[model samples]
Target: MSVLSRLFARHVKPEFGKPGPRQEGGDLPPHLYGVIAEFGKPETLVHAVHATRKEGYQVIEAYTPYPIEELHDAIGHGPSRVPLLVLIGGIVGGLFGFFLQYWTSVVAYPLNVGGRPYNSWVSFIPITFECTILFAGIAAVLGMLVLNGLPMPYHPVFSVPRFQLASRDRYFLLILARDPRFRAGDTFRFMETLGASLVSDVED
Candidate 1:
């Protein structure tokens, strides 16, 4: 074959719908957490959340110095499970306390004081109530912490210098990379087009 034809054939992509073999030892791209955008106002952050949701991005979070009630609905963020957890804990604690009291007075010790009867249901009320409240309070705090992902000393979003201001006055919105619709370049540009003052990558 002619040299010109040989060169052209060597450079041509391999046949029909089949992928060419990758380089033997190429490094993979770095992992990413997601993309984040900084906004100056609460309203703007809300707007961004709405826009992102409309764009079909489901995994979104907004950070502000103080809570914005509207954001709960904007991102389609679900209602918290802490309340339910607390209720369950309270019920369990109450049952345990009552049964323990029942077993001691009626089954094990069979105490009799002033002819008050071995099974004194009325006397157990105070301890049952106390145990219920104690367990419920603990459940509320623990459930909140677990659901909020506490003890996280590091997060990729913290890598952004301006994110420190999130607790002071600024507002921020993040779109996690796990979203099915996320494309780094496209999401970055999309966030910019929504009038964000700054946009940055969040490395995992």
Candidate 2:
């Protein structure tokens, strides 16, 4: 073969025949982090989630292509703490704004122009309002990130090749191995009973 042709073959072969994503376990000793069951229908997934919870699995998460209000009720996560965080942030910001203005007008740079009160309470309102909003917005974002564990570019579930369909048309229920009730073989069998289209172990 000509050198050009041989080089072209080598490059093209890898690109054209690139192996599919590695399977979930890939000859590893089944060091699993969880089991994910894929369902074709959202209703089935919701039922499976409820069943799993009823069966005493605590560390569970559901992935779906779209929002489903009923799913949240099934998952039963407790109330979020973001609102309290925002409220605390707003209160702190408002207090800081009020105090800063108070110090500036009364102590730091006292100005008695037109015999106006040095501690001008009315002028502090606008800054206090702005600061309240600014801090509350910041707290809302940070609290969400902290609560949701954001900036996590990768998770063990991503290792499952079939999981990519979760964003497209599939609903998945993941029962974490860390849950006290989880056993590799038993969980796999139980998931099969939940009407899952596909149930696979996830490796960390």
Off by over 4 Å in 1: 1-29
Residue-by-residue lDDT tens digits, candidate 2, 1-204: 684344233223222122222234323334667789999999999999999999998778999999999988789776676788799889999998899999999999998879989988998999999999999999899877766666567778889999999999999999876576776777889999999999998877
Candidate 1, 1-204: lDDT as tens digits: 674343334223222223223222233235666789999988999988999999998867788999998999998966776788799889998998899999989998986799998878899999999989999999889767766666567667888899999999899999876676777677888999887899998766
Per-model lDDT: 0.79, 0.80
Q: Write down the worst ten-residue block by lDDT for model 1.
A: 10-19
**TM-score of every candidate:** 0.83, 0.83
lDDT score for candidate 1 against the true structure: 0.79
